[model samples]
Target chain A: MNDPAGAPALSEIAIKPLKHVNGAAHRWVAFIVMVAFFALAPTFIYPVFLMKVMCFALFACAFNLLLGYVGLLSFGHAMFLGIAGYAAAYVAKEGLNIEAIRLGTIHIPLNIALPPFTPELAILTGVLAAAILGYVAGLLAIRRQGIYFAMITLALAQMVYFFCLQAPFTGGEDGIQAVPRGKLFGVIDLSDVKAMYATVFVIFIGGFLVIFRIIHSPFGQVMKAIRENEPRATSLGYDTDRYKLIAFVLSATLAGLAGATNALVFQLAALNAVHWTMSGEVVLMTLVGGLGTVFGPVVGVLAVLGMENYLAQLGAWVTIVQGAIFVICVLTFRRGIVGELARWIKKPL
Target chain B: MTDDYVLETRELTKEFKGFVAVNKVNLKVRRGTIHALIGPNGAGKTTCFNLLTQFLPPTRGRIFYKAKEITGSKPSAIARMGLVRSFQISAVFPHLSVLENVRLALQRKRGGSFDFWRSERILNALDDRARELIASVGLSEFEQTIAVELPYGRKRALEIATTLALDPEVMLLDEPTAGMTHEDVGRISALIRRVAQNRTVLMVEHNLSVVADLCDHITVLARGEILAEGDYATVSRNPEVVQAYMGKGYA
Candidate 1:
């Protein structure tokens, strides 16, 4: 029971706890389902296409971490993806070499000037870079909410895109090309199609799990509370702005992870990565997948990517059809594919 | 009632642009007692609460809790000092399960763990606290119910449980029993009594009988100023209090 001072052991002295909802079981089940789907994805579609789906699926889920869980609708999320892709491509092309020098009397062999371009290192660099950019943007973007929030994020992304266009390192309009897949830890060659497929799948799955863990954590609950009622959360003694900043950074990092993986797979980082259309595309993926459902974005990305691949020749029509889907989903099916399915299943999958 | 004071306001005034919403209102609420603020609509009861909680900056005022000046403090800072106000309408996480809603509030009170890694045991403890509060508020059966799915009365109960989870030293109820069935009103009123025994309570109520039944003291306001302050029986009999409620000239 709480005492007179209003300070009590919240979890320890509480009267009773809720029935345990075995979140671990739910996570394991989801993991199994995702793996099973991935295994079967290549059977019905091109393996490269499947890889692309997984990459965007991870990206959408990351974006959902902010939009769905934290109640932040960031319209400039592509900035993270594109910037990370650029970082990954530039790193791969230059190739890191570590230089070992002998400071003492002992003879040290000559070493490369930078570290090797391993997949893990590339992804790590990408994540860190995205997180830093996200932090800076969140500082500015979090001052407003609702439509203002969306517009500020969009403007910030456009600023980044223009900067990328003029930056010499990004190769301007031509973008980065012939980006090596790079040897994994200087061992496993990613040039092998099957090897590359496995690598991309692992990276996407890893990012997804990281986000899943964040959502289930206590921090995630705080984010949800802030989303539901910010004034209330503030009155409850939380610095809500700080929480939003952290969420933004985390979302950007995961998005960057996905973009980096994509660039490595395709051996190119194109202008599309930094475009506002890319930002819009991810929103659609999250919305179609189910705005807040854990695995909704996976389904959304697969469907959208499939449509794009199959309708390549249609060009402008693809935009029209996608626009129609957005309108239909917003007006009639607000819950989207995963949400409706979750309703049928009676759980927020 | 000198030592009995838990919250006291001295010349608290709130001005919005050029208009004064709450004009120089002085009030004192005893510790562990239910005090009600009653007035005609737009008498500034809500504005007074907002000022005391620091949700709105007071144009001119001083608020003291346990004799410490809290005027012009941030709402969260004030709340952290053991004062919390429940909104007129239900302010809850509707999509979250009833238990999750209460647990989140509790988790916040316990220095919410922002750990993005590791298990959520910190939240598990809050869930335990939430369940207890839910049961105490007669919502044990609806522990897992989504807040949005609950009948109107139950949502009221959930909101109260959440505010209680904040471990407030003084609880401000802004029409806690609003928009409820008579039966539900009785239940919430009973809960209010049980909660008041452990902490000071102040509420804004439109219903005279509800105030008469629950409050030890009632403050009547009209057009941003206190018209009368006394026990319910005394204030109800006051000509000024009657005039304010009846929309007549104050005698």
Candidate 2:
């Protein structure tokens, strides 16, 4: 037998064999349909609620970047999202004031201060922070494979969570609250619900397009190759570790973008963002939509957030319902909603 | 100082715990010649192949490729230096199409850019070459088929095509015909012969007929050591080679 340990798992096998049928046309149609739906959604659905769903959708897409394409299971991805939220919130509330230090010989007073950063700058800062954190975390985590990789990421994330909990900036239990939405580029006021919703819609669409591009890029092709057969990829002269690390950083950065947007949308950065349960939630969303399917995360986030919104009255029963959905999806529709749809259409989503 | 050889190993050894898998084995493959490493089931052929490819690091030894010491180099770095190896098992990306598989290998030759913003249509430039490779391997008809869905023989053919896409200077084939039908063996033999014309081919093969037909040089190994080394005709007639194959009492 071939290397059984190296072979993908049975569940992973089910997700393989992507079929592309009129791929470009299908993607265009999907994009149009999504934009149309978002355009009309505010008239019937609540704008704030839609913004929340979009935030989670972007988050799930970012998480799927590693799990679906790269075959990495990161149980600690919430740390990126959570850290980004804190960073964005801090920037929005207190702004940035970097004081330059004077060394022994050279006196370099490179002090800079910006009072209350714009929402765009704050989000950019959050994304950059996440990318850096991803580099450090990925450097350590990618040394191992499969379960060990997942464990290392989770442990590191837990460390970050503890840091946030103890750190004075995070406000311990209450978190950084009432963070100002700030102006967009110091021009457009984000205080208006419609304006904020429009910004989120654009961000979601932008993030979604970036992910779609990644899945269809040459780099993405190599990433999938590494996922399918890593040793073979190495033999083909790809430094697969570097590719995986870059992919991890990219995924984390996108997740951070989602988190920063969410913090601005809700005017808060709370412990719930960094909690382990957030990681599980993203996983569930990705799984429900489809592990590797392109539009699966969007469908998944909507389904999950919609259930949470409607089932709010059921209290603890919401968790039970979500669990039931997860079970049903795994047992019957393992390919996920969008995955099954893609399989049926014989096209890559 | 001789540069006639493409690959050479000096006293290459690998140990699992205390047992030696490949012990003090020296090998050399002349430039642009087809060489075969043959041994019985427990003769450490695959282990030796792995050591050369840097898949498994040697316990103690030195490996040289193109007159450069590469014992400590990474598998990927060696591949970049034009020393590539295939697996005993079909190593094609199961989900990618045959064309995409070859194209992906070709993409490595293009450039290393982690640019996620650019569209993959830029890869269409590589499609012509990828198609040529697929056609060379007689897999043009199955270019669009997902690799996992292809028949076992066809999948192996795709693996070869992908490997060839890299245009490797020294191609190491590990049991290219390990689990194939007679027809597949013939086709793959022909493919290997054609691809080896411009490059050095080092193969670990169990089929003696393939070795005799294709190999310009043969090395017979037994009990983690080289037993005979020469052309197939000369090595096949070696008394120890006969004993290694026929067993001591039978010989």
- Which candidate ranks first by lDDT, i.e. highest? 2
Docking class of 2: medium
Q: How many steric clashes does model 1 contain?
A: 10
Evaluated at residue B162, the lDDT of candidate 2 is: 88
Candidate 1: give the clashing pairs: A17-B128, A96-A114, A97-A112, A97-A113, A97-A114, A98-A112, A98-A114, A99-A112, A289-A296, B82-B169
TM-score of candidate 2 to 2 decimals: 0.94
Q: Give the best candidate by TM-score.
A: 2
Candidate 2 chain A weakest ten by summed lDDT: A1-10
Off by over 4 Å in 1: A1-30, A95-116, B1-4, B126-128, B249-251
TM-score of each: 0.89, 0.94
All candidates: DockQ: 0.34, 0.57
lDDT of 1 at A236: 75
Regions of model 2 farther than 4 Å from truth = A1-22, A98-113
lDDT of 2 by residue, A136-216 (tens): 999999999988888999999899899889998899999999999989999899999989999999999999999988987
